[model samples]
Target: MQPAVVAHRGASAHAAEHTLAAYDLAIAQGADALECDVRLTRDGHLVCVHDRRVDRTTNAKGVVSTLSLAELSLLDYGGEIGVLTLDALLGLAADHGVPLFVETKHPVRYGGQVEARLVELLATRGLARPSTKEESPVVVMSFSTLAVRRVRALAPRLPTVLLLTQLWPTLRDGTLPPWADHTGPSVAMLRRDPEYVARAADHGHATYTWTVDDPADVELCAGIGVRWLATNAPAATRATLAR
Candidate 1:
């Protein structure tokens, strides 16, 4: 089977990352999944923004945790795109039938409140848990094992991914952390050790790699049986995988 092509922050290479327009273009480009980074606003709303601070991506300059949803709404993302709420993105996902990989940013001021609010919002949208015998439209991913565990407690059926930048003690044996359904590694890890993907599969974990854009990297992922390729240029990656 062909690996699933996930848009890393919604075709971010072609447009501003995490904006509505970028996500729209990703769906148009035939991305099998949409990847997003989410954080909690001071007012307890979940918004799609990558960094802890809004400085780099928006007109405003401050920590995202310091701003309320109302205050964040006043800023322009990429000069024209408004700040996106998790609700808005979920609506688009439902309308387009695209699966979403929602990465929870860690070490925020809100602590576990971020995961709690996220599970609540997903429940309200009828997505907190997968329908019987079906994969959920949404999967939660995080670098923090605690965060992934929190989601498992809140919604057991929702798949969780443990993101790794490098080989860790937990992964030296090729097993996923307890309660994690999948393993997400950097593309560089696969390059350094192509056997890592196969080892992850041997231990009953599906593997996904992030931020892959180069055609050679795409080929490497395909050859290693990566279940998902998360990339900034989903259209180009999709075409590459089809070859």
Candidate 2:
């Protein structure tokens, strides 16, 4: 079976990252899930933003952790896309009946507060925890082990993904951190060690790979049985997988 095609930052290749436009396009394109990076605003609200600084994706400049939700609202994130709160993004996911892969950015001043706020928000939508992962509409992912642990602690039944940029010594033995529900590796790392997926599976951890835009990489991940294939162009990736 083809891996689920998740739109990384919501079809970010066609629209600006973290914008409603991108997510809407992703939903329209039949993306299996929408992915986003969540950061805490100064007032403790969760916003969909990849970078700590707003200079790249927005017209104005400020640190996301330093700005209030209202302060962020003034900026032009993209044409008609505007600033998107995790609340609004969640609504979009609910409306479209698609799942989400929410990544909490680490090393922020808010620290565990990021994960806390994420769990709180999920709880508000009755998504904090499900009886089983198959019933979950969202899954939390992070490169920080602490962040994943916090999520697991706050919501034990909530699914968590531990993202990998490099091979940690322990992972060489094919076991993920005890707290991680799944493993998310960068496409480059997966290319270097495709066998890690099988190894990880041997230990019962599913694999999710990010930023896979190339057709060859898509095929590679699909052929290797990646559970989720994150891409900037979900439509193209899905089409490639279809072929």
Candidate 3:
């Protein structure tokens, strides 16, 4: 079977990362799904930005949560590069009939804002759905277990992916990390331990790794039975999977 390919930040390698343009390119290349990081603006709107601050991706200089969506929109998010909002990204996904895998960044600081807004958006747009055990699509993933759990509560039908960088001693801990009191284990440790994957599966959640860019790492993840591999280089990873 062909491993599913998710476009990390929407074909970020060719276009500006996290912009609508990047996402469109990824879809044009026949990607199965689109991935994005969600952050809250000052006015409590969900935006498609990876960094906590806009300095790197935009012309603005402030925390994303501190700026209103109106302020953020005016800041040339596409300044010489890529820029997009959660709404725009979702709209594109809907138009292309592609699935979305949204990751909530800095869930600790944003509290329930990101999840709440996401639920509202999906509900309003009629994008939320229940995935079968064999064909779960449109997943919501996060390093924060709490965020994932919150999403589950808000929309039980929607599938969730637990993003990790390390392993935890307990399955419940997978929902919250020690640093942020958020749940979820690390993908790094799961790659090294089969038991970790089993534990995550037992909790009714799928495992996915992030920022994976190496062929060997992709092979290792595939060997470990991870359902998703989030990578910056989707085309290269897809080629590796083809082999």
Candidate 4:
């Protein structure tokens, strides 16, 4: 089967990253899954923002955690879809029957509270756990091992992804930590070692790659058997893979 096309930050190449407009457009374009980075605000709320600060995505300047959700809402994100929250995003995904890949930003002041809040939020929405890994619509991903483990501990039946930026022999041999159900490698790593896709599969691990926007990379990923293709151009990638 062709790889699932997961939208990274919601068709971010065409619209502001993490904006509702971008996500809506992505789903409309037939993206299979949505990926977002979430950060905890000062009030302990999880907001779907990639950066620690809002300076890049917004006109106003302030650390995301330093500002309250109400304060962030007033800032101009070029127009509508100001500071989208995880709760609102979950609702949108539920409405469309789409899956979400939630990345909890690490090295934050909140520490493990981020994962705790996520677990609580998911549980509140009746999605804390599923009967099986494949049945879960929400997937937790993180670069920090501790963060992913925290998610596993908080919600035993939930699926988690461990994002990899660097490649080593053990991982190249398809050895992943027990806590992670899937492995996320950067597009560069996949290009550097295409064998990793099949290798991961040998160990019963599905490989997901992030931010793949190039056509050649898309072909390479699909050709190498990547299970999930994360990209800023999901619609385009899906069409290319179909061909």
TM-score for each model = 0.97, 0.98, 0.82, 0.98
Task: Give a tens-digit lDDT track for model 1, residues 38-107.
Answer: 9999889999999999999998799999899999998888855568998999999989998899999998
State model 3's lDDT. Answer: 0.71
Tell me the alpha-carbon RMSD of every candidate: 1.1, 0.9, 4.0, 0.9
Off by over 4 Å in 3: 78-83, 108-110, 129-137, 172-187, 198-205
* Residue 124 error, candidate 1, Å: 0.4
Q: How far is candidate 1 from the true structure (C-alpha RMSD, Å)?
A: 1.1
Q: Global lDDT of each model?
A: 0.90, 0.91, 0.71, 0.90
Alpha-carbon runs more than 4 Å astray in model 4: none
What's the lDDT for candidate 2? Answer: 0.91
Least accurate stretch of 10 residues (summed lDDT) in model 2? 74-83
Candidate 2 per-residue lDDT, tens place, 1-243, comes to 789999999999998888888999998888999999999999989999999999988888989999999999888987654579999999999998999999999899989999988999999999997889877999999999999999989999988899989989978867987889899998998889889889999999989899899999999999898999999998899999999
Best by lDDT: 2
- Per-residue lDDT of model 4, residues 79-110, tens digit only: 76468999999999999999999999989989
TM-score between model 4 and native: 0.98
- Pairs of residues clashing in candidate 2: none
Encode model 3's per-residue lDDT on 50-120: one tens digit a residue.
88888888876888888787777777665444346788777888788877888888644779878888888
The Cα error of candidate 3 at residue 141, in Å, is 1.8
